[model samples]
Target: MTLLPKNPSRLIREDDRDSAVERLREAYAEGHLTHEELDGRLGRALTARTRRELGAALASLPEERAGTTSTIATAAGRIRRRGAWRVPRSLKVASAFGRVYLDLSRAVIEYPVVDIELRLGTGRAKITVPRDAIVDVEDLRTGWKDTLYKTRRRSRPGGPKIRISGIMGFGRLKIRHARR
Candidate 1:
């Protein structure tokens, strides 16, 4: 999604609604939202047709902290987290008919190993990690012609290890070292 300045008048996309729904789920998990409130907000979020509506759905939730574990899911939009964002100890990403990007070159890692759970249905995912990081994808299961590509890079001792475990139904999952 395009990272535009906070403009109230700009149109919201389906990805925005999905993001709002995720926030609502997080709020529910954090005890900030009751079951009824989460259901109502989720309904509004799924049916929201405008950015303002989506914003309203998430207005009551607290802002996400930088270092907390986050679950990012999307139905039909792109999900990309990059740059200097903090890498959660366990990050879960689920996508369908969308694209997922996890760039960990500049991420702050607090754990010696990060667990990444990826669920992709007819979507693609690209994970870029530092050359020194170790990536283990032994638990990944793919269906049909689904593909997973890992470009080799030297892995150093004591570097963060990324353990990926998930199910892939079609599409591709590519893991590459960050370009210098």
Candidate 2:
């Protein structure tokens, strides 16, 4: 039996939804959408399970965030991102049956806010953010275990903010602040 979903085509992947959300955020930032409009569309997008629904949620938005988002996917192997990698405004990281480790301690993050969407099927994801960075996991949805994170240090006044979302199915996510 394969780890891949039997009917993968019918379900909208979490990364696609994340891209749309990021686009919506960009539109909001550029003054294309009002707060009410963004909220409504975001609610719709998050609950949408099909391509049609997702498209409808993003119906009136402009084109994508000018390619500010990138995706890294692995169906059966590990995906690791670390060191001086240039972190985009929005990143979609997905793993179907393996581990994912993303370390932003030494990464070059240009944006004030970085969005990380993680979709794990049957493995763990370890994310290490800079000590001064702030993390927000309000949008993440777990299919099995809850994410493990403990805030032991205070974030800087203007440190970068990381927004994490997506689905974790039968997997665990451990997020921590990097040690200086």
Candidate 2 local lDDT, 1-180, one digit each (tens): 737446769679999999778777767766789999999999999988888889998897766434679999989998998876668899999888999999999876768999999888999999999999999999999998899999756677777999999999998899999987
For residue 18, give model 2's deviation from the true position in Å: 31
- Candidate 2, clashing residue pairs? none
- For each candidate in turn, the TM-score is 0.60, 0.62
Per-residue lDDT over 1-180 for candidate 1, one digit per residue giving the tens place of the 0 to 100 score: 857556646667877876677667666765798999999889888977777778888885777776656799988999998875668899999988899999998776667999999888987889988777888888988885544556364566787888989988887888887765
Off by over 4 Å in 2: 1-66
The worst-scoring run of ten residues by lDDT in candidate 1 lies at 144-153
Error of 1 at 10 (Å): 52
Q: Give the number of colliding residue pairs in candidate 1.
A: 0
Model 1: clashing residue pairs? none
Candidate 1, 180: how far from true, in Å? 3.6
| Model 2 / residue 67 / CA error / Å | 4.0
